[model samples]
Target: MKFAAVLNRDGGTLRNADLAALCDRMCQTLETAGHSLSIDVVAGKDLVDALDGATSRRSVDIVLAGGGDGTISAAAARLMGTKKALAILPAGTMNLFARGLGIPQSLEAALKSFTDGEIIAVDMATANGRPFVHQFSIGMHAKMVQLRQKMEFGSRLGKIRASVKAAWATINNPPAMNVTLSIGKAEIAARITGIGITNNLFGEGHLPYADNPAGGVLGVYVTVAQQRTELLKFFFNMARGKWRDNQHVEIHQADRTVLKIHSGSSKFRAVMDGELVRLDRETTVEIQPGALNVLVPASIAKAEAA
Candidate 1:
């Protein structure tokens, strides 16, 4: 298969990487595996154009996107519902989507995995009409992301530190909004401190990402914790992977949900796949099952088949 590799020069670990050498290694590895490859190392600002140019090529069968979750999510949005498949090179701080896809977190190991990769269809979600591979979250998560964006972060470790501090800030002054969730014929109303709709149900005792990306349903989680103590307990339970046991939390599954937020402020924010964006008052979130084609490690493919 022919591959077009787009690496974000300013994203996460790539900012300090030897990009030229890394690109050479990737090209050599793919070529030696009897596949053709073309690489583009561009600044973060130019990532979308590079991706567009690559995917527009008639000869390109797969787009290998290297960077953070946001970069991979952008690549997924372009490739979704298309014949082209996305192969991830996890160069991000969290690399949550890559972990969910069973892709190696290390750059070198991820490249090796791709040499024997197999293409598979996975689920993708959307907020209004915008596509996302991970989760769409509002309230505390959005507030935390918004806060982190303001702090100076030059490196991957710096970003992690910023996230921790931001999370603490969010816990102290957690955003509360009246939300109505419509799932099928059922409607639930609450004043939530945080709410998230994930591409698939998150596996327990692990990072907050789907273990089965093709699960064909959305995971809905709402936090009703009002006080600081309750919010702190909620965070602690989440970190321990026992959030479901928390009485202040509610978890559900649905193919689609209509979320209506009743807030006086017209400009609310939400976090989609780790990037902060303006939230619509009423957002339609749904899962498109098997809408994304991904090139994952052979082991993952085999295990899924079994």
Candidate 2:
């Protein structure tokens, strides 16, 4: 297999030495497995366009995205519906999408595993026609991602500082918005702080991507709390997987959903797979099942078989 590894050099914990060695090892492993590999680095601007041009020329069998979820999602946008299989390296703060595919955290292990993995179909949800792998959120979580982006954390201690700062900001100012949620034939009204719609349940205590990504439906979680104490309670409820049981929060599973911001407030923010975007008075989200083909461990197939 001829593969093009699209790498983000500045994304995660990788240093010069680790990255050099990873590339060396991956090249050797794929070569031994009777495959040819080409590595491409995506710089700051026009990242997707550059990779798309490279892959198109080489007719790459697999386009391996070696970066954060944002990079992977961007690359997946171009690779979807093509015969080429998408690969993820997960070199990010939270490798939720990569973990969902059962990829390993260790760089060498993930490369080796991908060389022997199989292609599988996964669902991709869309918000305003934008693709998202994990989940989309409205209020507090979107604010957190924005805050976390500004902190510029490279070390564990720096990450701690950023987290603390974001927590404080979230506590100090909770968002209040009137959201009109429409799913199937029902329409519900609520004053919400945030809304999270996931492709699958990651179970309690696990990251949202702990479940398989190609599950064929969307899991909608809406958070409705306007006070600090209520936010803490919401946290505990989500931790215990009792958010569904909470009166303030509403949970639903559906093939598609549309959320409209009916709040009289001026500005609002929403996150689609860790990337934040400003929303107008109205926004629509829908789940597009089996839109992307990805490479995953054979174990996933076995589990589905069982």
Candidate 3:
């Protein structure tokens, strides 16, 4: 396979080695197995254009984009409906999308796996017209991203530190949005603090997110907790797969959903694969089932190892 990669130089844990040196090592490792690989390093802001340029090279069969969920989402924007496949190198804070795809956390392991990967059609969700591979969410999750942007931390533990601080800062003065979620004939009217519509059902465990990205259904997760204590409890239980048993949070599976601000029409911030999006009074979410062709472990069993 002929492959090209764009690395997010400022992505999580990217300072471990010099950028060019690392790309050379990756090329050597893949080339040793008789596969061709080329990599380019880009700042997070430039990744979109870089992926566009790399994908334009018609000879490249796969494009590897390394970063967090935000970077992967950006790549998916260009790769969707294209003939080429996307290969992820997990180099982000949560690496949620990569983990959901069962890609290993180690960059080297991910590269090796891709060299032997199979092309699988995965689900991609769109809110309005924007594409997200993992999920699109509003309320608390979106606020956390906004807070993290303004805060700084040590490069070594920056991701962890920023997360803790962001959470602490957002828990109080929680987002107050009264929305009506319409799924088929069912309509839910609630004042929610968080709403997450996933591309597929997430696996249960500490992280509690989808491990299989190709599942053709959308999982809708909502938080109805109004009190600070209730909000904390809701997330805690969710991390343990105990949210289904919690009254404050509701999890459902659907093919499509429509969400609108029931009380007042206002523009708000939404989190799409870890990126913030400003949405109008109403946003529609639908699954573009099998909208993306991407690299995944050829062996079914190994692909769910996240």
The model with the greatest TM-score is 1
Whole-structure CA lDDT of model 2: 0.75
Among all windows of ten consecutive residues in candidate 3, which has the lowest summed lDDT?
A: 297-306
Assess candidate 3 and give its TM-score to the true structure.
0.93
Give per-residue lDDT, candidate 1, residue 199: 96
Model 1 per-residue lDDT at 226: 81
What is the C-alpha lDDT profile of model 3 across 1-306, one tens digit per residue?
Answer: 998888888776674547777787788878987889878888877877898999899999988888767778888888988889998888777787787777788878887787678888788988887888888888888888888988877464776788777876777767878999998899999889889898898777658667667778889998878787887777677768675667987888888899997655455688888877776688888888888988886674354344
Q: Rate the local accuracy (lDDT) of all candidates.
A: 0.92, 0.75, 0.81
Off by over 4 Å in 1: none
Residues 81-129, model 1: lDDT tens digits: 9999999999999898899999998999999999989999999999998
Candidate 3 segments whose C-alpha is farther than 4 A from its true place: 154-156, 263-267, 301-306
lDDT by residue for model 2 (39-145), tens: 86656365677668755855688888887667888888787667777888877767788878788887778877877788888878877777778878878888777
What TM-score against the true fold does each predicted structure earn? Answer: 0.98, 0.91, 0.93
Error of 1 at 212 (Å): 0.6
- Error of model 1, residue 81, in angstroms: 0.2
lDDT of 1 at 32: 97
Count of residue pairs whose backbone atoms collide, per candidate: 0, 0, 2
Worst 10 residues of 2 by lDDT: 10-19
